[model samples]
Target: MTKSLVGYGPIRQTRVGVSSSRGFDSESLGYHVGQTLGYGGERVYGRLDVDYDNKGGKFDSKGNRISPDVNQTDQQDTESLSVNGSLGVELTDSQRLDLAVTYYKDEQNTDYGPDYGDGLAVLFGAKPSLKAIDGANVENEPYTEKSSVNLSYSDDDFVGSGSSLNLTGYYRDEKGRFYPSGKTAGTQASEVWQANGLTDTATLKKLASAATFVTQSEADIEVMGLRAAMQTETEVAGKKTLLSYGADFERENSEQTYYGQDLNTFLASNGLTAQTNGLTYNGGPDTTIDKWGAFVNADMDITDKWHTSAGVRYQKLKSETDTFTPIYEQLLEEYFNSPAISGISAAYGIDYQAGDVEKGSTDHDKTLFNLGTSYQITPNDQVFANFSQGFTTADIQRALRDVRAGFVVNSDNVQPITTNNYEFGWQGKHGDTAARLSGFYNESDKVVRFTDDYTVEVVDTDERIYGVEGSLSHDISDKWQVGGSVAYTRGQYDKDGDWLELDAVRLTPLKGTAFAQYQFDEGSNIRLQALAIGGDDKAFKDQQKDPDASALPVTGYMTLDVLGQVKMPVGRVDYGVYNLLNKDYLTVYHQTTYGDLNRLPASGTTYGLSYTVDY
Candidate 1:
């Protein structure tokens, strides 16, 4: 339908401009340039924006390595380019259409690992760096990129007189990959083995020499979707009313690949590829999902004091996957067939009973509903209550991979979870002050737990959570303003009927922020802000995998900062002194996700300045 409507032709440019900025940061130098173009004739009008940014190195919060090598630090770094555009066409007096497109690429060093502030600062515990490796050159380079296009059409006659119909279709292709991770057979192998219950260093070296073990992953995703909506505006029984209905369909396919690092020199100097195909396996799975849903809603003036709306949706989703696991038997086959000494059974005496394995799939569907109503107390005040349902499938790939080697992976073996959420809140504004308060609770038969491996581990247990949040802002004078927000939350899981506090990873700590702002002029302003986070001790020797896993209690801390903007004669400048008080601290992600071995300090006080000009 879109092919027949929009014609391909040269765009007539109307306006164009470019802006650039130079930034100075605590650890590095950076800059970015942005350009925009406006084009169209009478029927077609649109604008395009493009930008390129070269961020500085050591940009990550903990990027300052604990014990860094000459060039083996800055785990968190990025460089990128992006483009976005939207166009509209007036097909007729009563019909119109719009199109939007987006694209971005993170030109980053994908396989470069993050600094844990501990190890010898090497790659995969084996290689010195990516520059030293000759194998998996393309495979070792992980990256992120995506492109998408969307089309929307609306017409009054699409449905009937007085009824309007809207149609939208979109397609997107995206790919993202992360760095390689594993216990390298290099210098750190001895320490890693000790942690995993191996003592004899010689035997550890001998076994590690025999094969390469690590985990790396990436996903190539493609999506195509379509949705149609129709609405009519008319008077119903002398009351102003509106009714709308819509249905949507979408199909997504993601080809997931997970494999170990390709170590080129494990056997000897410039030795054979130790991480051979027989010794390797894709720990990730290819997945496809087909989904379709429909919903209807009605809203009416009903009265000037009250407004109400209710909607219900019936959705069906089917998830299918090509599950996988390490096929060790393939190692035996490669051993006899290829020149590489691939078989682990002969040299290692390790049990390879997981032969002739079979893969499985996951299937789920649900019907969801929702309702909401709001009452206007005054011109600037309102209160609302709402309830809703949500459904999703957990990380089937991780669950499938964790299956016992001898068992099969199916819906019966690798089950997914369904979740429900409930929320209510109030918001109002009076005079020069505004405020909001909210409470939320959610539960599920099984919860999706995130792990440091960058994978979701679905725990087959009943989990419940409840929390509340509040925010307030006030203008003390024409030149002064103040505001703040506070939140508190807790969660627990059913463990054999003895409910236990959730891990710090799943639990939200008590946190709050306050700020004060002053205006020097209409175009210049400055602000000061502060943040505080409370600690947690739930998983500290309390959970099943206790006493030293993610068992470390989270630590609390507070910090203050100053940020401001001033209009200059040539352009505008933005500056900030983050962590102004130099309240030295570490990231909460560290304590809640990793053990003491990964104890790394967060960034100290840092400063930033940037200037921009529009032309």
Candidate 2:
């Protein structure tokens, strides 16, 4: 009974590798197995991979090992595994069906280690007690789990000559547990004054004496989608053409749950009524999103040297979130409105009466379009341009977390982001060299940004980015070849109509890369590459808000790398030395999480070696 399905024997391979690095310490081990076999004259393949990577430690300019910052990999200190397989079969002469399934898990431990933060505010004439929610964020393991299943069917003659239809269904689920980032800048000496507007030494000490804690977060989502598409070769304008249309429906139920623990004293220090259960609260609402869309596109050859394509899509989206009253906000409102507690609040510059909890839902129906064309200027040169539109909503949980009681969430705060993109590019080859160049401009009506404290910034306005990029490769000779690429971009968003620049996360948009390779006669080659990142000091400091709380300046730096592969008795051994120049530079991440204290530097130099062969 077991011998009939497989028409041929299985082909299998196994891979094993181990790597370690210093400066910024990291160690990893990997093992993988893959197999392909014939099932009834068709092929089916499956793969399994297991990996363990412990990424920790940072370095200073002097190459001294140091503790990583909160922005770095807190504890990727565990093992991850994944398994996937695919199968395909022919249902008829013109019909086919395919199925695939995947599963992955990454579970790891976090050693929060004895709460540390007392010495941070020493420069401000105080010692702040910084603990991770009194150790709640500590002594816990975090993990990510994901699984997916996909099935597809296609028929070339479903509607007769020159017509086809394809259908697909997919389902996926993802779950994750994450630890707290770190205590806010208020606990750090440099950002103490910015946290509390008070400048007096006495009040500074009072602010520092307050105990601060962190939060723990968890989220999960299950999504299912179905799609149907049809294509037919037809003459729309008496020209050779193809038209395609598709409709898709996607529904996902996602929920985010956030909880934190803090002392009752901490609440009282901020003029908020102490919660009966402390500061533990659901930071946002549980949410579900339903979306469906349909699109039609056409491709036409207007002439021998010109081509054009265009499409439009209609989308219907609805998001619903549960109503939840934050414990801390409720406690604050209680304290503020109570005449009995007025004196306690007035001592801290009491504000007006805070209102009840806020929550709402948002829905949208819109149509989007995309257009593109290309014209050939010569056999080896052509230029193309396109315009496209994208639409989506901001993070619902974040919007719920930062809601104002009196404002309407559905109408104002929780709005969809609509982005418009324009791009033009040229591709060509001259002699033994080939080149490509492109420029693009993009604008989004709404975007989200985060500060070091994990507080959310709902842009809700316009974010515009424009950039130009180009790459060139030349065969200097048969044995020597060189290529390089460079790109520059400028990004800014409207904050209350005052356009502000983007920060380091992705906005450090100037970069250049160059590589040169030397080939040996036996198909072995060694390549050298260099990367240069331009400094960005304008965006972070240009606003002139609070010096200590803002991101630090990033200086330009360059690093070189060498890679080569040599054939041996067993297999082709691939080796590489990264950061060959050993340039010591601080990562943009180290500065963006929080300011000036305990910044992390990049790795000095790293090496890697691996080999693979068919059996």
Q: State which candidate has the highest TM-score.
A: 2
lDDT of 2 by residue, 369-445 (tens): 99999999999999999999998876666656655455555745577889999999999999989999999999998
Each model's lDDT? 0.62, 0.65
TM-score of 1: 0.79
Error of 2 at 170 (Å): 1.8
TM-score of 2: 0.81
Q: What is candidate 1's CA lDDT for residue 84?
A: 88
- What lDDT tens digits, residue by residue, belong to model 1 across residues 166-238? 9999999998765544333233324434554666867766644443434455678899999999987777778
TM-score of each: 0.79, 0.81
Query: What are the runs in model 1 whose C-alpha is more than 4 Å off?
Result: 1-27, 39-42, 59-77, 109-141, 156-160, 183-212, 234-240, 264-280, 326-359, 406-411, 414-416, 450-456, 541-551, 594-599
Worst 10 residues of 2 by lDDT: 268-277
In candidate 1, the residue pairs with backbone N, CA or C atoms under 3 Å apart (3 or more residues apart, or in different chains) clash, namely none
